[model samples]
Target: MKKIEAFVRHESFDAIRARLADMGLPSMSISEVKGSGRQGGYTESYRGAKTTIFMRPKLKLEMVVNDADVERAVDVILELAHTGEPGDGKIFIIPVEDTVRVRTGERGEIVLASHPDDA
Candidate 1:
């Protein structure tokens, strides 16, 4: 199993979610996050003062998929999340040791594939 963590522009969340769902990988966790990449954020002017904002809002999306699905999952994220501009964000794939479904106490990749409807 592998965990796919994507930090993307907030506006891209819905489209990405819909696309991933269509791919049968609907299970995911999302969080509002703020960070900067090579662009390093920007500056704004208020009255006669200028403020440099180093942190920008983004959506952190995380999902676990079977090892075989890792490339496909990453492809969906890359295709939907790219904007050809800075602050478009990044994707990280990490190793998942195991997964357990809380209610049934079932474990491993099987747990990830089980949806509530499967109960």
Candidate 2:
């Protein structure tokens, strides 16, 4: 099993989510996050003054799936979230020892099968 974590631009959330669903990769956790990358943050002007914004808002998506689905999931996220620009975000894949379905007590591959990773 594997856990996939992706931090993407806030504005791309809807498109990414829709693409994930279309690929049959459902059951994900989404969170609003703030961070900066190579581009760092930018400066904004207000009331004839400029202020530096160090942290940019982003959307973080996390999910656990079978190891075999890792590549496909990553591809889907990259394709949908990429804007060919800096601060586009990144994806991380980690090993997942096991998983359980709280409602049915399903475990491991059984739970994974319920959430098909068909990207």
lDDT of each: 0.88, 0.84
- The runs of at least 3 residues in candidate 2 whose Cα sits more than 4 Å from the true structure, single-residue gaps closed, are 115-119
Clashes by residue pair, model 1: none
Tell me, by TM-score, which candidate is best: 1
Residues 1-119 of candidate 1 have per-residue lDDT tens digits of 99999999988889989988887888999999888888765789999799999988889999999998899989888988899987788999999999988888989988877476932
Model 2: per-residue Cα lDDT at residue 40: 57
Count the clashes in each prediction: 0, 0
Cα lDDT of model 2 by residue, 1-119, tens digit: 88999999888888877877776677799999998777756899999899999998889999888877789889888888888988889998888888888988888877876544344
lDDT of 2: 0.84
Off by over 4 Å in 1: 114-119
TM of each candidate vs. truth: 0.93, 0.85
